[model samples]
Target chain A: MLHVTTGAASGPGREPILSLRSAVFGYADRAVVADVTLDVRQGEVVALLGPNGSGKSTLVKGLLGLNSHLGGEVELFGTPMRQFRDFTRLGYVPQRHTLSASVRATVTEIVAIGRLPHQSWWGRPGRTDQRLIDRALDLVGLEDRAREDVSTLSGGQQRRVLIARALAAEPDVLIMDEPTAGVDAASQQVLAEVLARLAAQGTTMLIVTHELEALRDIVSRIVLVGEGHLRFDGTPADFVLAQRRQQDLILAHEHHHHDDDSDVSQAPGVLSTPHGPLEQPAQKRGVES
Target chain B: MNTLTTLTTLGGLPELLDYDFMRRALLAALLVGIAAPMVGVFLVQRRLSLIGDGMGHVALAGVAVGVFTDTAPVLTALVAAVLAAVLIELIRARGRTSGDVALAVMFYGGIALGVVIISKSTSSTPANLTAYLFGAITTTSNGDLWVFAVLAVVVVATTWLLRPRFFAVANDEEYARATGMHVTALNLVLAILTAVTVVVSMRIVGLLLISALMIVPNAAAQLLAGSFRTAIRYAVAIGVISSVGGVTGSFYAETPSGGTIVIVAIGIFLLASIGTSVRARVVSRRHQRAEHHPHEHGLGCGHPAVAHGDHVDYLHDGHRHAPHAGHYDEHDPRVHAQTADESETAAETTAETRSS
Candidate 1:
């Protein structure tokens, strides 16, 4: 058994950056994710993992107020979600497909958009804003391509540009939805390095991903969801151990089924290796996931 | 023929400027040229290129209302267009009706109502509606010119001041919302700006063809500009040239101002398209020709060597050059995927012969 703490036990008096209590998230009262209790403290990197149709994405959207809050309490930076207005403190990196392909904006122009939250309606970018934008482009290693049109870039480079846009805001907590999805392997490695560097800087991040391979080392905790409920919440090592045990149980049950049935080949096929039933649904929504 | 002879025999531009109506027409055209594309770039970015046409139809209804109530046509048109702009934005924001469908309904209903109302008005004539449908810039009064000036200033100043915010919403509304921007408000502001642009341009470019002045120059500018800022600059320049040139051409040819303006804008667009294609071909041909370099690039050639797929390329000057069988082959990463590999040997032979 693992001790599932509401928030990370890094220090005694540290407050949770994001807290949800029995949160029910959905669209128009049709709940997709229900009875979810989670808390993220300062400087903790948490990965929200779930299969397709498990409502992980809906939950993240709920936290951002994109989805309907069916019931329960959600808080950000110790304030209630309804009363919380300091949105600049939170940076969101949506999926790369969210960017419209028709826009003819330069890399610098896109990155400068992240500074809008800090700027007044009629104000231009000051020296500090320019420095931050430059630093963000530098962080993504895209300073050289700052003047090029974003549509001319490859898919992975465009993802990096999105990340640079989010980082330019200097948010206290960064929330990314599948930052490595649909990216090539080399770009995935680069994205992982960027996240690792951000983690080293003590930036709190809640990354929603189904696969943990790219962000395995950077993720401090793992929260697994299945069928719209929190199935497991623990350290990464404990989660791995739990996954292994579940795999062993499936394999042992398949062995018994093999003996009982004349169709032995079908028994092994029932138990998919490595991921088993928990990770199978991820491939169901291939276009989106 | 007579106007053409006068244009040739006299100093045409200076002589034409001597008339009061000509001065008003030129000023109105200049303002429309400057303001239309300034608002049009964002409309094009949002893919609402036809929204200008819809708004133009609505402004025609406003003109009918002015004729029916015996009021200034420009004022009533501005009022009607602004209301319709807000209504369309609200319907779009509610998400119940799709945007293009709403715009279509507005377009047909507006023109139908405009024609019906104008036909019933006692002061209306078919010629008055014709003048609005196709512009009669040479008939613009000083009062109409003053109204155009005010509306043009409002459109230009608002689009310039709120360009970044407008771009953010137009590029990606969800992303702008995530950044804590007031997207709904910005969208309404954009819609109102579009309405103002439509009204400002209706007298010079005509309500029927105002969208052309708003969109064609932008389309032409995008072919050559590498950035959005540069595109806006180029689009405004094209808009100014097309409108002024069209007005001058109409004076010489005895044509309607709106048709002449749209044709001039289309001419510029065709030129830009052909120029872009020719420039691309020229760049590729240049890249195909390899310069003669006596210094061989290798492991210790003092130049940085980058590992390409299965081969090494040496960075020289600004581009990379890979050593082939006997000569250096220039490797442009930008067009690497498009250029065929079989032509390398033939180009190398050409380079060798030229060097010899």
Candidate 2:
């Protein structure tokens, strides 16, 4: 696991940056992420992990207000999500490079767009904005390619350009859908180093990722979801140990059954359950596990 | 006959400046040429290039309404086009239908309704409609010129002021929304601007060919431009050249001004296609050479001209000095490091369930 000190754990007075209270969120027809209650504190790097179709991304989208809340409440920076206007305080990096290949923008131009929320109406970028943009580019090590067309860059370089764009906003809390998807191993290591540096600098981050290989070391907490429910929310080490225990239990159970002499047909006759419990079988299984 | 012979005898260009009709037509062409392509570049970038055509058809219906109700066609066309633009935006926002589908429904419906409305009006003859459809520059009034000039200036100014914001919204709407931009409002503003530009451009290129004015110049410019700013400049240049040349040629050839202008724009697009393809080949070759022969060279050197930006200051400095210059290797440690983070993030983002 990665080792990094973050502000959320270090400071006793750390405030919650975003909170979702029993939030039920989804499209018009259905609530995909239901009854989700999560609080992200300042200077914390929280990773959302889950299997496919587990509503982890949906919950994150709900927190971002991309999906409307069917019920419950969501707040950003202590204000209600709907009323929150300090967007510059929260930077967002989407899953992929959504820009079409036909776009005629350069890396600097793309990064400069991150300054939009901070800019005044009809105002161009001043010295401060330029400095922030340059700093962001420098952070991602893309300052040298600032003038190159974004389409000319490789996928990984383009991803760095996007991160630079998000960083240019100088956000207090950065929410990335997935910052390392489709990237090579070396890039992941660099990303971890950059993120480690940012964590040390006290910039909070909420990242959603499937694999915990590189990020397991940097993240302060892991929030896992399964089947639209919050399955686990704890430290990275605890989550990893619990995951290993779950696998070990399943393997041991399979081994024990294999060693047993009784056939499956005879076991079914011997182990009988009442029909009344069928309605809540999944819930019961969840509790037992 | 006398004017045509006079135009032909006196060098085919200078004598045309003496006629009032020719002067008005040329001015109208010049204004629409600059304005149409300017707005068109943004529309094309936004992937709504057909919005201009849809609005033109809507304006045609407005002209028919004006003819039927005994009102100024231009004024009524402006009103209808703006209303249609807003409607298009609303429909697009609903996400029930694709943008192109919505535009097609509007374009064909408006033109069909226009034809029906014109048939009902005794005063609206086929010849009169044909003039609106194909453009009769000789009939362009001073009032038309003034209105076109003012609207053109407004469109150009608004586009310039909101260029960066519009590009942001156009490039990645979700990102723009996350950044706290009122994306819907910006889109509405774009729609209104497109509507106004379309209606005014209709005066020169006519409804049937207005889309050509909006899309062709921008398409040609995109093939050659190094940046959006340069694209706008190139698009406007192509627009002015094509429109003015077409108008002048129409006077000498005695053909429909709008049709001639569209033809010229197509010819320019063809020429740009060749230039773009040749440049693409040269760039690929340079990339191959760089990959094979790894050497420490300045950023501006060894790279193809297309790869070098239009920044004159950078070119002057970059050509002389090598800053962090290195070999072009796909497997560079830095590249691998960058790729690892990018793919992991992408994979993670796609791993979980999404609602919308």
lDDT of 1 by residue, A1-289 (tens): 1122223334546777888989999998799998888877787788988777778888887887777889889999999998888887888888765366555788889889999889887898899999999999877766656777887666767888888988999988888888989876766776787788778777888899865988888887887776787766767766677567665666686677866433233333322233344443221111211
Chain A TM-score per candidate?
0.84, 0.83
Top-DockQ structure, candidate number = 1
Local lDDT at B295 for model 1:
51
lDDT, candidate 2, A52-119, per-residue tens: 77787777776666676788888887898878888878788887844555547778888999998888
Worst-scoring 10-residue span by lDDT in model 2 chain A: A270-279
Candidate 2 ranges beyond 4 A from true positions: A1-3, A6-9, A251-289, B1-13, B98-103, B282-356
Against the native complex, each candidate's DockQ, computed on alpha carbons, is 0.29, 0.26
Clashing pairs in 1: none
TM-score of chain B of 1: 0.81
Kindly report which residue stretches of model 1 are placed more than 4 angstroms away from their true locations once superposed: A1-9, A251-289, B1-10, B96-99, B288-356
Taken over the whole model, the C-alpha lDDT of each candidate is 0.79, 0.73
